[model samples]
Target: MIKGIKGVKDILPEETPRWRLIEETARRWAVLYGFHEIRVPIFEVTALFARSIGASTDIVEKEMYTFQDRDGTSITLRPEGTAGTVRAYIEHNRAADPLPQKYFYTGPMFRHERPQAGRLRQFHQFGVESFGVADPRADVEVIALLWRMLSDLKLPSMTLEINNLGYAADREAYRPQLVAFLKQREETLCGNCRRRIDANPLRVLDCKVPQCRAATEAAPRLADCLSEQARAHFGSVLGELEAIGIPYSLNHRLVRGLDYYCLTTFEVTSTSLGAQNAVGAGGRYDALVETLGGPVTPAVGFAVGVERMAMMLPLAASSSESASVYVAGFGDRGSAAGFSALEELRLAGIRAVTDFRSGSLKSHLRQADRLRSQFALIIGDDEVVKGSAILRDMETKVQQEVFLTSLSSQVSSLLRIS
Candidate 1:
């Protein structure tokens, strides 16, 4: 037998309801915020990611699955949504249509990496992006939408960690200072952090490796480097979040894992997710549209891992019990009567099923028990002759006879199903 690929998972029938609930909840919350849905291709020219996500970020350097297409153009399975969404925004000239166009998308994202509890090689995300909005209110809008989404899921022990990355020039001035500090413990830092110093020095603060984290504990905080305008922009975001009663914590080191993010960056983390606790994260990207070869546009967005959201939501509450009816038909004439009743029950707004097995009454009842149906419409040779069928409540083991002529209405009233 052929085996499925490693690091990817099949969302089997028993698991779909949990996924559907997460997806529907995200969609409902996004729509409430006036965000429409936009979908981009699964693959795009590799340079789009390289330019937008950052050449030094892990997603671009190691995670992305890139290959040469038949025409020799480099292509990659998108590792994140914002870059692709921005590409579409610029390609379609959405800037010409509206001031701040809001869109939300839910789909799979591919990254070749080690698979763990909630992390997968091919994982899914629900993302929201707001374009052409440079105000601090725009920052609060996306952040509030993210907080409301996870809160709506009833997830446990989640905290909102917010950080200010300031503007590009703020980083440009602070790089030498940060690099000088990093080089002091050069040998003690992780290989990735050491390499990032010359390329993307800010990433050293976000490193999760124990030694890298330790070496950078006393490193300069980016918040101090924030420009006067950037500081006020971040302050307004906090004031709004507080006014709305959404509590948040200020984290000085939470430089998100992307190149385009600037100004406000925040993440919602749940302790229940163990060491890798981020449920979702995003920030303002004011320069991305211009970077991707389009008119300058300001944008902010967030992406939530569907798998982690599933892990936080209780599986039992994710799915509701099915109210089903089984048609247990015995004998040739009984089978014919049962077939008719099956269709009638469904048309009457009942969940119905059949095994198409013909046998004694006892065997048919066993089938009904296996299916765990709420009601079983049993038809035997005698019931068929009488133009009636027995409605057995699988739970109470109670049976009643109803006419086949008005089977649907009679069952509808008898079971109170309709």
Candidate 2:
């Protein structure tokens, strides 16, 4: 039997409501922040990610699903959303319109990695990008947006960790000092950290290997290397966050694994999700637009893992409940009446359904009970002749006759109760 490929799982019907809630909440809050929606293709030319996400980054080096098309052109399913979004911003001449372009996107992203509890080969993300805003307040606002969305989701026990990576020149000065420090402990570091010391020393700080983590623990901090300008920028970002009462902690070792990010970086972690604890993260990438062949643009954005967020959502609110009504009919005349009444309830915007089989009233009532319907509208030859039908309350099992024309109003009254 054919099976779904490993690392991919179906989002069945029962689970979609929570997914919808997350997506809708993101869209709602995104609009409230004046961010317009932007849709990018699921796949793009391979070079887009390689250049924008950094050639040596794990996303590019190890995780991207890259392949060659029949035309022999390299292509890749997007591992993240920002690169494609920035590409679209450039391709469409969006920079010409305004100083700041705010866009949000929600969609599937692909990465080839060992799937864990909340992480998947095919995962969905809700991301937002703000371009052309270089002010430190832009950083704070992006962080605020993320905080607000997560807060609105009612997640429990979350912590926001932020750090300063400084500017390119600042990093250049610090890079040598960090390398020299790591070189002394190279024998104790993991193989990956040993290789990264020369290629991208900052990545070594992000390594999870126990020995490498210990080796880099006492190493030079990025904050120590921040240029005056970078320090002021980061300070101003913090000042804004403080003024607004958004609590955050500084973690000097929290360098994000992206080459493009600079100045300020952040991640929101929840205690509920073990191991893969980071629910969302992003940073300022002031040079990425120019790196991707567009005019220099300053941007800050963050993406939340939808699956992880879904996992933490409260189950009580998401569980299915009894629908408003089930329209059940007994015979030919009764079924016709029930169908007409069903349409009336529907056109009135009541949640209504019917068993079209025109089965016996007892069987139809049982079907309605099975469906968890709040009310069952039973129609038979006698009630059809009288221009009315019996409305049976499924829970109370109380029966009442109602005129066909007034069924909607009657049900509306019943549904309004606490």
Candidate 3:
């Protein structure tokens, strides 16, 4: 037998309801916020991520799956949703519209990584991206939409960690100071930080190495580097969040791991999960559109891992109860009657199943018991001659003979009582 690939999972039938609930909740909440759904291709030109997500970032460097197609064009499976969404927005000239555009998408994202709890090589993300709006109110609106989405799922113990990375001018002014501080302790820092100092120095603050963490405790905060204009904008964003009663915390060291992010960066974390427990994160990317060779447009968005979301949502409340009706037949003639009755039950809006293979009544009931069927419709050669079925209630072990024409009404009434 052929084995499945490592670092990927098959979502079994039993786990589908949880996935369904998550998707349903996201669709409903997204619609509530006036965000329509847009889907981009799973694979796109390799240059898209390099220019938009940052070539030096881990997502583009070590994690992405890139390959050449038969036509010799380089194609890559998207590791994140925002960059592609932005690409579509620019390519289609969505800015031509007078109003800001909001879109939400749910799909699988690919990354080549070592598998761990709640992380997979091929995983799913539900994301929202808003374009053409630079107002601070837009920031609060997006964040509030995400918070309400989590609440709708009945997730537990989540906190919003909010921060402003400031604009390009603020970040540029602070880089020298941040670099000088790191340079003083270069020998004590890890090799990654050593290279990061020259490449993407802001990332030095986000390093997870214990030694690097010890070495960079005194690093200058981004808040102090904010330009006067950037500071005012950040203040306005906070005021809006406060006025709307959205809870948030100021994390000085929460420099988002992406270079494109600017002005605002935030994460929603859950306490139930440990260190890598962030369930959702996003920030503004004002320069990303211009950087991608499109007319400058401001955008902000967030992506939530479906796996992590599933871990937080309570399991289905009624999963333990039997909800289906099973139809069984004891002989070939009885089988014909059973199938016809199965259709009748289905037309009457009953969750009904039937045994195609002729079997003993006892064996069929055993199968129904295993399936946890709410009721079992038993048809035998004698019953077919009489044009009636014996309906057995699995829970109460009560049996009653009902005419063929009356079975649909009886089952419908029983299900309604349920």
Candidate 4:
């Protein structure tokens, strides 16, 4: 039999409550922050990512799932959300609507990478983007939104790390200094870091290799080279974060992997998730809108890996209260009556279920108990004949006889008390 591909796992029914909780909580907090929901396609032209995410980045060079369509046009399954969101922002002429357009999106993102505990070939992300907001307040507001959402989820041991990548001009001036430094340690640096020395030198600071990390320890710092405007923007963001009581640590080497990001890059890491600790991250991308052929627009946004966040979520509390009633029928007449009652209870906003197979009263009760059903409604031939049924409170082992006319209301009242 054919099976699901490696690295992509199914979200079984048993595990969906936690996913629902995360999505609901994210939507709730996003709305509170004035972010409206936006849905973008899962795939886009390959150039969108290569141009926006940067050609030298690992996402475009190694991780992207790129394929040639029937027309020989290069298409790719999106590995991230920002590029698609900005594309939609420009395509739909959203820039004309208002000064800043806020959008939040949640969906599966595809990448061809080795699967790890929290990382997957097909994963999900919750992202928010705001366009045309050039002020540092936009940066602070977006980070605050992420922090608030995580707090709402009750995640523990989270750390927010912030850094300034400086503007393009600052980076341009610092590039030669950084490259010259890395070149001196050419043999000591990792192969990836060596390649990036000339192509994208700043990414060397983000390298994970032990030797590279050690070699770059004394490398030039981007923060030291930040232009006055970049420094003021970052300083203002930190000031606002302090004003709002959101504590953050300054990480001098926190340049994000993407090339579009510039100034005020930040990441939230969770100690609970080992190795792949970054739960969410984003920064200012003031040049991306123009890069995508739209008018120059400044935007700030962040994305949290749903898989990673789900890992850190506490095991959901298990309560039998959700499934309120189980309908148990003994015989043909009893089955019909139980089925009808199930429908009636559901129509009245009661959570109800039934066993399709005819079984003994004892067997039905056992099934109800196994399902953790709050109450079991037993319908037998006698009950059908009498136009009433037995309601058994599973927790108390107490039974009551109720007429069919009052069954829905009685169940509702009983549930409220329980």
Q: Could you say which candidate leads in lDDT? A: 4
Query: What is candidate 3's TM-score against the reference?
Result: 0.94
Off by over 4 Å in 1: 321-323
Of the two candidates 3 and 4, the one with more favorable TM-score, higher being better, is 4
Query: 132-241, model 3: which lDDT tens digit per residue?
Result: 88898888888998999998888899999988888888888999999999999999999989999989888888788998988888888878878887888788989999
Ranking by lDDT: 4, 2, 1, 3
Clashes of each: 0, 0, 0, 0
Indicate whether candidate 2 or candidate 4 has the larger lDDT. 4
Model 4 ranges off by over 4 Å:
318-321
RMSD of each: 1.8, 2.1, 2.0, 1.6
Please list the residue runs of candidate 2 whose C-alpha ends up more than 4 Å from where it truly belongs after superposition.
319-322, 405-418
What lDDT tens digits, residue by residue, belong to model 4 across residues 1-418? 9999889989976667778889998999999999999999999999999999999888999999999999999999999999999999999999899645999999999989999888899999999999998999999999999999998888889999999988899999998999899999999998878888888888889888999999999998887888999999999999999999998999888889899999889999999999889999999999999999999899999999998888887655322245789999888799888889999999999999877864788888888888889899999999999999999999898999989989899888878887
- The residue-by-residue lDDT of candidate 2 on 1-418, one tens digit each, is 9999778889987788888888998899989888999999999999999998898888999999999999999999999999999999999999999645999999999999999998899999999999999999989988999999899989999999999999899999999999999999989998888899999998889888888888787998878888899999999999999999999999887878778999899999999997999999999999999998899888899999999998998655576855689998778899888888889998989889877764898888888988899989989988989989888889898888888868899778767862
Query: On a 0 to 100 scale, what is the lDDT of residue 156 in model 1?
Result: 95
Q: Candidate 3: RMSD over Cα atoms?
A: 2.0
Ranking by TM-score: 4, 1, 3, 2
- Give every collision pair in model 3: none
Candidate 4 similarity to native, TM-score:
0.96
